[model samples]
Target: MAVHRALAGICLLGLLLCLSSSPAARAASKPDYLILTLMWPGSYCASTQLTEKCCKPTNGEPAADFLVQALETYDSTTGKPVTGCSRSCDFKILPLVNMLDDLYTYYANLTCPSNSGMPHWKDVWCTYGTCSSLNQSLYFDRALRLREKVKPLVNLGSSGIIPHATKSYSLEDINDALVPRIGFSFTVVCTRNYILWPFFYDDYLSQIRVCVSSDGRSIIGCPNGRESNCGDTVKFPPVSYPVSSTVIELPSGDEMAL
Candidate 1:
């Protein structure tokens, strides 16, 4: 019994040490808002001179796996007990996975040949199932026919607006559609050593990148460009060229291949 108690104490101490050993650990020590940036289907992917893997469309299993891993990491690090990371009340990933899964199935069904002896999906009797009949040159044309079906997954849902409580505001409250000018915090998380957060804001503005999620409708970090003193809203998602082509220097005196 004494030996078992000592072993349990040692295990607990090891767990505590692991939780306090690094900046990432420290950042995860408390519950903070995690910014989840899903890679859009159209977004550029990393590539190498010898490999043209960049810009390739994600497959059915890979995308889902990536999302799951991201959510698990965020949950484990944040110490926040949440069921999942979807757009629902808790902003967990389950809903997003379900959305993408449905899309993948739809796309796969559309890829099937019409005369494959398989029953056609309801109301989908058009030229969709005949993708196999088209030539390579006509592939793009056929794919465009499915564009409307795939568009919703590409858009980032709105993060919504922060109201003054007394002021009347105009605009549909949706993510990516528009965010109001209000107090917010810009959070950046680097998953890999070389990854950098892509955002732009002037230091002169009254903005702070607090380590916690904005509780209300306040801007997550900074207001829109219309409120800029220079009068030109700073374009965000600050230019990302190929990381391999451009060089970036890390704060730790390490040069990145970017």
Candidate 2:
């Protein structure tokens, strides 16, 4: 009986060690932060050639620029992304009703055209959001609030990289446009969809992701391994709003004001 008990204890220790070494375990331990990955609607439309898969314009003039696409979490030290940490999303009480409209507007499920914003929000929550120290309301609400803070289009336009045509922009020019205004530097990366995106262009602006601290307030840099892979000369495409005819104006809608 003594020998058997010792064997069982050893087996338990081994099992614990094995589980601790996993990606999920390692990801859970380190300092974690929320990552906001914004996608250009124009680039998505142009690259995939799927104009129908875009979020439809509502309320006022279409937002034809960088739109909030994804919210994920990763380790702050290692820059390793950790997702799907648990099956449960902390969606105990449903989010604020007012946030639902803001969600559909900013956090639209462009990839999943048939569905609403819940899948995108829920998936993000179930994966990275759940892993965070933040609760469901805090997690989702923070995204809406963060959106209010970061507006790259307005800054970039002011820097003379206006949304008109695909221009080859230096890395310095892009960063110069953002850092001064937003007060935080961003990682400018490009799509790996070489076949989908034309070779006539260099890497196009895929995502301008910013890392927010664990408290979900301050912005931090992306993790070490997750730095930008974009070349110096990147194609900054024109912001395209899938429109019937045309309207040229900054996004001026009451929905945006809120």
Best by TM-score: 2
Query: What lDDT does candidate 1 reach at residue 238?
Result: 17
On lDDT, the candidate that comes out on top is 2
lDDT of 2 by residue, 1-258 (tens): 999999999999999999888766755655467787777766665565443455554322335667677667777656677676665444432444556556655665555344444545666777777777777777777776776677877778888876546467787788889888555546877854355345643577777887787767877755453557887777777755554543322323432232
* Alpha-carbon RMSD of each model: 19.0, 6.7
Question: How much RMSD separates candidate 2 from the native structure?
Answer: 6.7
TM-scores, all candidates, are 0.24, 0.74
| Full-model lDDT, candidate 2 | 0.65
In candidate 1, position 183 carries an lDDT of 25
lDDT of each residue in 189-212, candidate 1, tens digit only: 211111233353221111112211
Off by over 4 Å in 1: 1-28, 40-43, 46-52, 55-219, 222-258
TM-score of 2: 0.74
